[model samples]
Target: MKEITSTMAGTVLNILVNVGQDVSIGQEVIILESMKMEIPVESQISGKVRGIKMKIGDFVNEGDVLIVLE
Candidate 1:
């Protein structure tokens, strides 16, 4: 399994893919709000979405896993 982790502390703003959905490399998977800015988190691998570790409005620290791929 592969995971997409948060690069910085933030609140999960949006999730673009659902569990079991196929995702491509570079596709925007989640949007994070940090420092009053919106940051888009992209998929680093092409695979099926196996899990989502965070929910909208949830606060996350740097390096926190956001999505899992398989």
Candidate 2:
């Protein structure tokens, strides 16, 4: 199993992948907006997305789990 986590504190701007979707390493899974800048969170491991931990417009902290994969 693998997890995609937020790299910094921010509001969720977008979710690029859906549950049951395949993802590759370095693929953007979520976009977060902080300080007017958009930061894309990428998957470090390739796998099928199993879950999404947050929704658009939700605040997330660094290291928060964004997507679960297996």
Candidate 3:
């Protein structure tokens, strides 16, 4: 299993992948809003999305686990 973590503190703006969805490396899986900027959070590895730990409008801190892949 692979864990995807947030790179910065921000509010989750969108979630692009659903559970069991296949994702490629570098694919944008989530959009985050911080400092008035839209930041795309991408997948680091290719795999199926196993779980989502955050939801849209949720506030997250840097290094918080956002998704799990397998």
Best by the lDDT measure: 3
After superposition on all C-alphas, the RMSD of every candidate to the true structure, in Å, is 0.7, 0.6, 0.6
Q: Model 3 — which ten-residue stretch has the worst lDDT?
A: 41-50
What digit string (tens of lDDT, one per residue) describes model 3 on residues 1-70? 8999999999999999999999999999999999999999988889999999989999999999999999
Q: Tens digit of lDDT per residue, candidate 1, span 7-70?
A: 8899999999999999999999999999899999887889999999989999999999999999
Q: Write model 2 residue lDDT over 1-70, tens digit each, in one string.
A: 7888889999999999999999999998899999999999888899999999899999999999999999
Structure candidate 3, residue pairs in collision: none
Q: What C-alpha lDDT does candidate 3 achieve relative to the native structure?
A: 0.95
Pick by TM-score: 1 or 2, better one:
2
Model 1 lDDT, full chain set: 0.92
Worst 10 residues of 2 by lDDT: 1-10
Model 3: runs farther than 4 Å from truth? none
